[model samples]
Target: MDKSFKIYVVVFLLLILGYLYLESTKKQPINWFPSYAENHKIPYGTYVLRNELKTFLPNVTIDEIKIPPYIYLEDSTRTGTYFFADEAINFGDAEFFRLMEFVKRGNDVFISTHGIQIDTLNFKTKRLVTGNLDEKVFFKFYNKAFKSKEFTFNRAFINQVFTKIDTLNTTVLGITGYVNANNERTNEGVNFVKFNYGKGNFYFHTFPEVFTNYNILNTEYEQHTANILSYVDSTKPFLWDSYYKTGKSGISSPMHYLLSSKYLKWAYYMALIGVLFFVIFEGKRKQRSIPIRTPLKNQTLAFTRTIANMYYEQQDHKNLAEFKISYLLEFIRTKLHIPTTTIDETFYKYVALRSGNTFEDVEKLFKFCDEIHLKNQISMDELIKLNKMIEKFKNTIQYGRK
Candidate 1:
């Protein structure tokens, strides 16, 4: 109804609209990574390389191994002789020795592009060495577009070869085609190698991308993957270590993630409620008009007459003389429109000139009035002369005449 209330309503509507706009934008779900497996028609829940192993190691009767996050290596047993490392991390020295023992017992271990911490183990002493490779090499190999971008395969598979060659009783099998730093294809002498450890044979392929579905379909890597799988004996139980299947590592329970999301949602709702409460309670209230009360008009004159009659009835001479001087002073001020408090000589001069009276006469009249009030004494004739002077001063000021 009021102007201020209308402004508040308009502001409230704009705030609601703004909040809705923000919510609308926030409500839209964000898609982080595209569904590459679905789009490319790959089998769900299987890595590109592991999927290839199913066909490649058909003779070995491959058994897919699903390792849970933060697993105890000792608690788990392998039915087949092979272990796969996809992208799993936090595998300590004890686990490494257990794995090496498995290999020593005539088992095959296959590790992918990342999560291969083989350098941490000492083959001669059968102990952990606490060794770490350059992280830059791993990051580049995993993230770099192998098919779209040209990358040298020389350094790519060299680590795999070095791992096998450095180990006890391991031999060089063969190498894949090498490329120069400029991505130009070149023969770097060797691509892959083989190692003989007692009765067990260690085969290492440096180019893990060759086994991926993207590379398997390509003419260059398909033969390499097929050739590698051809070495497997199907009669022996096969273990597809899908432990390192996806690039994701350090996974938490689904319950923990969901609980955190719910807490954040509750905090957001509480903040919205607080803002709404402030707007409703602290906003201005409606204003009302205050009524006016007028005083009785003629009260001043009525009081003056009442006081005058009382003074006459009492007949108190000293008080009557003081009252008469006060009334005459007030009458002169009101009628002449001159301030009673003004003591300036120029004001008296102006009053004398306007009243056709001498300056000495006006001065004497004001002096006598003051003298009567202070002395509290006045003759009847002096009072009559004072009244006549007051009447004459009033008539001159009121009529605007000399």
Candidate 2:
């Protein structure tokens, strides 16, 4: 090989080697998005919680629920806990009502989200967004049994406390909030509560991140998560919700496989880069440039407008009306497919039927045109009237079919 070709090959090889080295050495960043998907292994996902739920309560039969509460509740009737843990579970009107009914029928519904408020049921939530960086949130159970150190989370966790509740039916289960900077024992409000409804109970918890993989896997924080779930009656069936998650369960698309892994994603990108490089370097095979040609413009509408304007400016309404009548006849022949040999009863009948206009309207329009055609000099009013009638008839036409 020549010296220049050898140099080109060497450069290409170096580029490929450099790309491989970069790809091998690159470190993927951590994803901190609060997806709350039971399948995701991200920091805020509940994958660890879902996998270890059986170990936590071996007696409880775990069933994965992929459909919405409304559809599932309507189709089947069962006694179990409908467990939901997500960053947000904003139920629709119908779904929420259906869920309430399900709970009323003596089935427990455990929902853990950022906030909880059912104004109709005399339950409300209060939020606190004070810029307190040092103060931490203290989460502890109100029950004296299983007494342990209060679990604390950093300032990243905000407050969504239960501010109001029905005293007769509601019971505070846990208190979690900044409460007080100097004294964590002070009550800001309760973040966890239990409501005694019809025949069942509603367990509401605001700290959804406790159910996430991060907290559940943390050695120091794992016990806290267990403490929260201690309230669940595990002897019954446990329906683990796969629905109402921010990061939906299974996302399948053409790019799903490649994008799911960094290596495959980068490999696909490298292939695209190679194609682009080939187009830039080797695609120019000494082909001659093809000249660009502009298409001809149709000036039919402009020409018609110019003629109409000239006729109006010269006050030749008689001839202009005649011209319009002639064009109208031609349009009817081509568009309506009726012969212009005579403007008789049969012609009017056919035109009316095809153009979707009443027979009387069609007959009246043709009579007016005929009257204008016979006049030597027509008024501007008569010309305008003729134009209006013609336009109205054309607008009502069902075109494209013969």
Candidate 3:
């Protein structure tokens, strides 16, 4: 409607178009963070797996293990398989010992990750060397019961495989295959391994992404995850870990609920807007408006005119001439820096030199000055001529000296 508003709309539209162009041309962010938290719904998050575990095992109670294993050991009755899904399996010396003792007391612990901290357990990972540049990596269970033979992951990633295993107390479950530079397929890389502890077992799998929401949602991998979970002892209750992967253990936060709910978020924005409007309106009312200031009118010209008019009305030409002559003599003394006691040739020469005027002109002006003092009354013609000469002399002099 308005011209300024139309300009604003055009500028806003241009900005939007520019942003869209930049976004199209800009490189998308690489999602390298492995957020395996139960609450996160990202591609690599285990929210679906956590939920599926709850649904599939309804009879078994699944409690969150927030604190360290030592604290968890305080609960004497708490006995179940502690499930952990993360990018890495790092543990403190105390936590490691606690977990070992925990499993020794008939409790099991399942860890699915790409990395493990302890080196004592006999196992070495061998990364597949290949030049085929294949994005999909495949894995299949060693057990023959899985009707669907092998499952292939379409995403671009590397699969960790256990090349060495302690066959004395460990058993290999699944193996990952990789193509070498020679175009030969090798299945020596094992993805799953189970170690027997005191009275329980420690299950470790390299492919943790298979249990994530993105993979588990796929029908092909859903069965794959179920088959893996089959290894867990169903007789014992489940203990879902929500602390290590994420740093928190809870359903959700109060701030999260406030932000997620549309009404609450909108309410917060509206309250902020109301506060801004209040500050603006209140400031306008409280602060005083600056008054427009006009400079005082110059009355020098007006005063000169008024004095001239009064003198004309009174017919005081002689008095005016006398006053003009006196002022001219005083100006020559002060401004020209010359003695004015005698109005002779020497005075005329000094005045002419200081005022940058002709000697003749200075002499003529002083002649009028002498005549004005001698005569009792001055004629209008003479007064006018005297005024002209005085004004001419003033124009020649330096302003600063004046």
Model number with the top TM-score: 2
lDDT of 1 by residue, 117-192 (tens): 4554322111111122322121112112233222222122223324223546654444333333464443332334
Q: What tens digits encode model 2's per-residue C-alpha lDDT throughout 106-200?
A: 88889998854477668788775545565667787888885746887652865688878898998888887565557654445688889988888
Every candidate's lDDT: 0.51, 0.81, 0.76
Worst lDDT run of 10 residues, candidate 1, spans: 122-131
Clashes of 2: 0
Give candidate 3 misplaced runs (Cα > 4 Å).
1-33, 179-187, 246-402
TM-score of each: 0.39, 0.66, 0.55
TM-score of 1: 0.39
**Superposing all C-alpha atoms, what RMSD in Å does each candidate have to the true structure?**
40.2, 15.9, 35.7
Model 3, span 1-402: residue lDDT tens: 589988986796687657555755576564445788887777778878887786666567788777556457655676899988888767755467778787888989998888886455676775654456743467778877886477777776557888777889898888877644564565447889898889988888888888888788898778778888888888898988776784233436888777655567656655775687577658778988889999899999999999999999988889999889889878877877889888787667666655767678788878778778898887889889999888878977755223
Residue 15: error of model 2 in Å? 6.7
For model 1, state the Cα shift of residue 247 in Å: 4.5
TM-score of 3: 0.55
Off by over 4 Å in 2: 1-20, 115-117, 179-187, 286-402
